[model samples]
Target: MEELWGRRVLLTKQFSAVLDAYQTFPAMIDQGAYMRCTRCNTELLKTAILLPSGFYYCPSCIQMGRIDSSLQLIHQAEPANQTREVFLDWQGTLTPAQEEISIALCHSLAQKKPHLIHAVTGAGKTEILFEAIYRALKKGGRVALASPRVDVCLELYPRLQEVFPKETIALLYGGNEQKYTYTSLVICTTHQLLHFYHAFDFLIVDEVDSFPFQGDKKLAYAVSQATKEDSCLTYLTATPPQALLKEIQASFIISQLPARFHRRPLPEPEFIWWNHWAAHSKKGTHLGKLYQLIDQLSQKNHVLLFCPSIHLMDCLFQHVQKHFPDLQVEKVHADDDQRKEKVTKMRQHHYQLFLCTTILERGVTFENVSVIILGANHPVFTKATLVQISGRVDRKGAYNFGRVCFLYDEQTVAMKLALKEIKLNNQLARKRGLVDEL
Candidate 1:
């Protein structure tokens, strides 16, 4: 339009639309007034040149140098429509076998189908995401790849950046910023979706059944509202939830890869009850079986002892450190600011013994990890948590000698279910020849 007040001005539908939105918002910045393009929710930068017609046009999308202030383009240009094939490393780069399955999964997701690939931990699930994302990007669409933990996103982002160098893929987390111009692909924590509204063309939810994301309907609704109704939604996880199973129809696609890189079997976890024995000593306690494991591993390598709480972790740390004074013992948890540095120290072998809560149970990979779950019988241990904890060891190679000790006072329901679930996964992997004869 020629004038903001009134005018015998001519305007195209798009400029009229941009103008319509601009009028509704007050010029005051702190008045809680901001204008976002309804189509993309793209906020016009305040530095943008305001036309006489009072339309704020992003130079990136539209340009009006002079003459009519109605955004009659000096030289009309199309919105960015460049789409390039990109790879996404969900785990890392893929091998020939992994590449095959990745290709299949990509096709399935692009077709708006549901498929399950029960790949083991360290099966390179992150690298496998590349093909799927590439297919969607080449189809001229935006993709949302989300995970329940910021830990997973931290690992998933850099690899995606390497594969999709041309596409803008911003990593979104609670404390992170949106630093890209217009992201065609996004790696984000599930919580970050709360601020989105119809912002993507494809949505991929990783670790779908893991924690916080599964329980929050607002996050789920955020995913739904952040995409067009016809957008493809891809779900990835080692284990599936009851709700996901119920949502399945024939249109869903399923794939399975049950082996690690070296093809060694998933570890066998043993249960030992030292409750009766340890209970006899009111001073402190030790499960003979777990103690034996600690002694054996300490002779050769470091050990990761996981407990249910901070108090339990400290108690174990003290108890273990007393007997092995020559050894270094360190711990990490939510309350510690040195948590990351502690983990780094452990990785560098600064300490031969480490006690940790569930925080270190993921994202970080250890080559020679021997996991011992104290109080495995406690109700705090769930199938998913146990599975994640167990995933820490023997990332590659033959049957790892590390022992997984589930030492408990009693075998609670959580213990039984976690054991059963792990064994079931092993059996599934074994059938696929994912494990050695052992």
Candidate 2:
């Protein structure tokens, strides 16, 4: 490996095209790694590169890494006293599995090693992120933890504020209305990442395979565009896509948590198919399951029912209200401004049942909550959604006897895939001794 000006000369890894450097030979290697010849895919021992820019290379299909090889003087932004992080770290206790994952992520960030973390539901993945966030802040490096939902940002804001008492932090998202400064750490949606141009030093994307981020190539592009050169990105997800799964299988680092932070087992979802499910109401059978499930649980506990659409959710709420008038039922959706009120009522125990769409699947956690997914076969229901919905129950042991059941006229391809992924992840974790095999 040789350095010209500030750029690195390598044959294997590819740097981004933004680097002005050019090379005549196929990609060259710094350490004998094969740099594929562009014209003929042949291996070349010597390579010529044009520079002034740090570094550049073709990873067969990608452009990545530093532009110049010269010693770099990194300028880190200092946050205001308000944004400055409090010295207190996560006081909430974590499981050994959680701690192991945290230690690995801290190491990865320090070494600039990229990774894909596939932990189980209720794995306390966010708490594991604390050490890495602290490392970045102490180094005065910019950091970002992005999710696809605003609710997640809202919930994470206070937690971040608690950790970084003196440090300033901003929450960004659609209609967020929060002002971001150069030095502030940020929690935001994938869309908000687009507003940043090479800004963050440490980027962590939660729910990497979740919708909008997973479905939209541009959102992924936005996340890449938001990071500074030489930045380290750690992706967090429960259900990684197929390509990522294969990559993790080959070399990517992974950590697994089969149990919630409370060490309670993740509930196994039973598929419920009623005879008149489709005949009476495409969604009615699902509603019936909810009614029955809630009735069973209401004798002692509260319940949450997930729906794929708002129209049907409203229908279920209206239908159940008459018989269960004694039970408080509420409907909440993305467009509903009364969401705070609805959530508050549920938390206050004013509402016994919540009929919601997929919006509630990921961020929110309720105590003693038993969850049921109505209309698992609904066209909008996807594999990620199903898993997230199932994740809602038994978290942190806020409840005992947690149950997550998927109600469907006929199970969709997505649900089956979800079940398969859940079992596969649990099996892998158990095989590695990360979690016990059921």
lDDT of 1 by residue, 36-124 (tens): 43212235554454555575543322221122223232111112336665654334566665887888887766666656555666777
Clash count for candidate 2 is 33
Task: Give a tens-digit lDDT track for model 2, residues 1-438.
Answer: 112211223333333332344332323334454343231123433244334464434332222232222322122222222233437555687677788888888887877767677777778787888888887777767788899887777777887888778766777777655544444478888766644555677898888777667766556676766676677788888777887677556555666555556644567678887544433443444455556777997776678878777776776677778759888788899899888668767767677888888888887767778887877887777888888888887676444776777778787899898888777766655565665433
Cα displacement (angstroms), candidate 2, residue 79, comes to 11
Residue 248 shift from truth in candidate 1, angstroms: 2.9
- The C-alpha TM-scores of every prediction are 0.74, 0.75
Model 1, residue 274: C-alpha shift (Å): 1.8
Residue 376 C-alpha lDDT in model 2:
80
| Every candidate's lDDT | 0.64, 0.67
